[model samples]
Target: MTDHSLYVLLRKLEDAKIPFTLARDRPDTIRVTMHLVGERTEIDVFDDGHMEVSRFCGAEDIVGDEALVDRLIQENRD
Candidate 1:
């Protein structure tokens, strides 16, 4: 994603009290992932501002924040 968008996302996550880590995926790509109680969410940001998010959950259902996932998906997609 664009630098602005990524910054906004990081701010949102911080505001929501969600803990995540950012790492370099490629020369022009960044990867952000959050580790929740029983699940994980990953978002990959590209230099051109495109993004893709994936959620991984265990067999049991969870009560994590759905709004955050929705916002991420809505904001970042092909």
Candidate 2:
């Protein structure tokens, strides 16, 4: 996200007293992770001011792209 948007988001989180951790920070993107309501949530902010949010219910909730899934299945085939 743009610097302004990232700043605003961090400010809001601080104002709300929500605890979060920085998973990654780079020139092109920033990743924030937090736990809420017993679930893990992740937010990725891009330099273009675009954002994506993902929530995982558990370990089983993690997933990959179709190609990755296919590879995993093939590797495990009997």
Candidate 3:
């Protein structure tokens, strides 16, 4: 993202009181990661004004009974 966009994003995050960490910082790109709810979100902002976003759902956030596993297996076989 552009510098302005990056600044805006950081400002919004701060305003909302969300916590984020700088995972990587380089001359070409900056990577930020944050956990929200039950998932982790990653954002990469490049000097070229491009951005990428990714989300990860941890296994610990998953909740289900034994029947849920069977249902998942059945669905996967379809």
* TM-score of each predicted structure versus truth: 0.66, 0.61, 0.63
Count clashing pairs, candidate 3.
0
Worst ten in a row by lDDT for model 2: 55-64
Q: Model 2: per-residue lDDT, tens digit, 20-54?
A: 88866677889877667667888888877788999
> lDDT per residue, candidate 1, 1-78, as tens digits?
545767878888999999999999689879889878878899987877788999998866555698989988999988
Where is the poorest 10-residue window by lDDT in model 1? 1-10
What are the per-residue Cα lDDT tens digits for candidate 3 across 14-45? Answer: 99999988756678878878768778898887
Instruction: Give candidate 1's error at residue 78 in angstroms.
Output: 31
Candidates in order have lDDT scores of 0.85, 0.79, 0.79
Q: Give the C-alpha lDDT of model 3.
A: 0.79
> Which regions of candidate 1 deviate over 4 angstroms?
1-3, 59-78
Enumerate clash totals for all models, in the order shown: 1, 2, 0
The top-ranked prediction according to lDDT is: 1
- Against the true structure, candidate 3 reaches a TM-score of 0.63
Q: In model 2, what are the clashing residue pairs, if there are any?
A: 1-45, 1-46
- Badly placed stretches (over 4 Å) of model 2 are 1-3, 25-27, 58-78
Candidate 2 is scored at a TM of 0.61
lDDT of 2: 0.79
**Best-to-worst TM-score order:** 1, 3, 2
